[model samples]
Target chain A: MEKRITFKGVWLPLALIAPQIVITAVFFFYPAGQAIWQSLFIPDPFGLSMTYVGLGNFEFLLSDPFYRASFVTTAIFSTLVTVVSMGVALFLAVLADRLIKGSGTYRTLLIWPYAVAPAVAGVLWLFMFNTRVGVITWYLGQLGYDWNHVLNENEAMGLVVVASAWGRISYNFLFFLAGLQAIPRSVIEAAAIDGARFWTRFRTIVFPLLSPITFFLLVVNVVYAFFETFGVIHTITSGGPQQATTILVYKVYSDGFVGQDLGSSAAQSVILLALVALLTVIQFKFIERRVHY
Target chain B: MVEKRGAGLWLTHVGMIIGVAFIFFPIWLAFVASTVEQQAIVRPPMPLLPGDKLVENYTRALTSGVNAPVATMLFNSAIMATGIAVGKIIISLLSAFAIVYFRFPGRQIFFWLIFVTLMLPVEVRIVPTYEVAANFGMLNSYSGLILPLIASATATFLFRQFFMTVPSELAEAARVDGARPMRFFFDILLPMSRTNIAALFVILFIFGWNQYLWPLLITTDPSMNTIVMGIKQMFPSGDDTADWPVIMATSLLAMIPPVIVVISMQRLFVRGLVDSEK
Candidate 1:
């Protein structure tokens, strides 16, 4: 049966695959390979001389305090954003699951922010945090608390996290809500009959059943924090107040695009790629089994 | 017990209402701020109601300096999104049909390769893509903005997954009717997969419209900027007194298309999520 398949039928798939393969090779594979290549060589901006420096770029990154801080910042940012967004999403999803009325309306309203483009979300948050005109700033000022994210490091980080969490909660909520709805009501009734309270029922019944959704969301939210939050950071502070909020990807963007240091930027990207790949592998290996699906 | 449960439900609804308000307030603020004067915006105790400056702010944002015209940006975004959506749907359908219906060597490997690309985001290869675009002289061109993103791995993967759920008997029936593969794909499979296609279209359109970094990077000319990039350019560096109302107004304007698309396609959007599970 397999041998009977002919070239006449295969041509369309082959043709379809051709464009994808070529695009990936040129845009995805080639660029990634070149980034690795550039990482090994130091390029002089004036003379355009590229000299090979084995592990020198890596050494420079390791030795630099700013680069070191980026690793810590990236870790904290990704983890906090993922954990908080997932928690809020799960909380809302559970609440949404139990509601008898207005559930669909609530779901739609909740997911509205997810529909807003990240750029728009960033801009909106920027305005909301604007010192003079920002609604949040005005509200904080009424309480005699001066909140200026532009100059303070901790405040800047806090604002970014809040904005990131707001933008992220929608996507996470959708997934968790779906996951919650997938759970059979009969299962919850069984627990209810067994005299399980809300917390007890959630712990023993709902939470484990929602594990796969949670795991999937965990990985996705982490990756999103690493890659998607660049626009927010760029728009909000431009990594300002002396590079306080510059995560790894933003650092890569600034170095390569703004600073015009392609070699170091490429090197930084390589590090980021490795870090992401490691996290991905770890999630698959360790967390995959824990996921119910 | 039933009365207590009803009370709990009421409390839950009340809490969710607050949550909804929190989610919506920023957007509402943007809309309200767009209508207010700059001085009024900075005034203590911000106005919760719509202001009189809506027309003036909208006018200034539309007529702003060096920014791509709002009409042209919308046109460009629509053209790019349509091209990408149509191209992706076609490519995905063909490839998914092949993976699902055909008995081919190395089929699983090809499928896996596409799936792996989903995890590897465009950010990783952005620098090299810039160079590739420059090499092809696509910089500052619409082709440059739309071409690289045309063949999406995620779309292909999604279609393949959806097609797998489609019964094999249908394809076999088509072949029994003397239908060639391409003919069956175009006439049978394509039409049957309308829901999946619609879902993919909404997803891709939103993603393409929301795209910022790549478009900003490739399109050096201000004229080529998309709506998102145009909003970004509104903030001038080293300028103390930036135009707040114009910025808010433009950002609000930029959001209208995607918001419209999402509201209209809400059913398809929810269906897409359900389909992903299969």
Candidate 2:
């Protein structure tokens, strides 16, 4: 919406916007352009020269088994992280919403984890599940199950997923609690009067009401798992135990920085850019619908 | 809540207690490990209570432990976080004011340009961004840590959203009073936006403090490392037995500032999260 009254002056506005425009152009747009441009060319080894390969890098990425595997890994990782975190959060939010007292105390205790960095969260979890000194690993060993993420691929993936999901629970819990509280208590009370059990009332009257927030959190959690879980994977597993835990973002860093495969990494970056653009579109579309509602 | 409480209320409390315990367990374990001596932690299932070696472990970590002292990393982190939070707030506030308050050429284009940045995060364009930083000689510096991270479209949009809600009559009245644009902005709009600016500051401060990959890529020097990235470097390479007590102490130290901000400014933090995401 345009303001009905705006001051007349081009210079002030220009001066005001200059900083944002310059930073966006230099840091954001320029590098984005470079990523797109460099994706089309392959650099020869020995840090020498670039050859125009057009679609060769993309084709290589698509055909390569490992690149394809990372796509699958990313999907699996995001799904697992989203579901585990959101499920636990929903359970806690429902319990918190039902409380008459102590909810604020519970919330304060639960929400501090949101301030913990994903990388730091990973270290905490890593310490818990570390091979030798890990308390959880030691307990599991007493149960006759040898828990070693360092060597086992599934264990490695599990470790990273848990670590990533750990900090995320606080965020999802906050949103879910807000959503749950927004639901009319009268509706649930009416359901109770109609002889509905607590579980039945939640399933019939509450779950549908919470769907919008659920969908919103789903998108946010997936986007988070896609991009922000880099630290979790880096600290916990390093995408180890035979690349079993390497999500797409991790692969971009490893290939581009560590392996020096510029073309493939740039191609991967372009592909990821497309993925984020699609997700952002979906998110905005959802927001638009919510606004209309 | 609908029915009289009996077993259900007790059950609810139990469930919440369990949830809180689950959330707090990992941090508690880290705190426990941080207080103990190295030998106590190296053994399986370290002591649950706080140990006598708290002073020793924390002092070691803060003074002369690991890759670089934790104190230096904390100082670097504070600077980067403050720089990013202040820089983004200023640029975003000015640009958002310009976009909302001025009818200018290419206003729509500028908005879309900022909007497009919302799509691609730094992770997608890491290599090229790294090269850009290197070309600008920004690596291993505070500018490298803060500048590339400060073009936040979220903060800009949040300000723009806030500005659009401001009554036009306020501006009209100001203009009628012969107040210039800058004067009106400073006296009227700035006062009105105090809550939003404070809210965005809380969120942005946490974001800047928690940064990992950017600092990891840019800062090669240990002296320049932020606390979040510095912890990873504390782990001894090549299996010579990591100093668990010191590492845990550093981990606890890394979380203090952000956690304090969140707990103290919780209302603003929640408002910022909901608004910025919107």
Residue-wise C-alpha lDDT for candidate 1, range A151-189, written one tens digit per residue: 888888887877888888887888888888888888888
TM-score (chain B) of candidate 1: 0.90
DockQ of each: 0.50, 0.82
DockQ of candidate 1, scored on C-alphas against the true complex (2 decimals): 0.50
> What TM-score, to 2 decimals, does candidate 2 have?
0.99
lDDT of 2 by residue, A50-115 (tens): 999999999999999999999999999999999999999999999999987889889888888899
Model 1 superposed RMSD (Cα) = 2.6
Sequence-dependent TM-score of model 1: 0.93
Residue A270 in model 1: shift from native, Å?
1.9
Tens-place lDDT digits, model 2, residues B1-278:
58538998899999999989999999999999999888887888788898998899999999996989999999999999999999999999999989988888888999999878874668888999999999999999999999999865988888988999999999899999999988989999999999999998988899899999999999999999999999999898887888999999999999999999999998888877877775
Query: Candidate 2 recovers what fraction of true contacts?
Result: 0.80
Interface RMSD of each: 3.4, 1.1
What TM-score, computed on C-alpha atoms, does each candidate reach? 0.93, 0.99
Q: Taking the true A–B contacts (Cα pairs closer than 8 Å), what share appears in each candidate? A: 0.45, 0.80
Clashes of each: 0, 0
Residue A205 accuracy (lDDT) in model 2: 86
Tens-place lDDT digits, model 1, residues B175-268: 7888887787778778888888898788788878888788879887877888877777877677476677788788887788877777788889
DockQ for the candidate 2 complex? 0.82
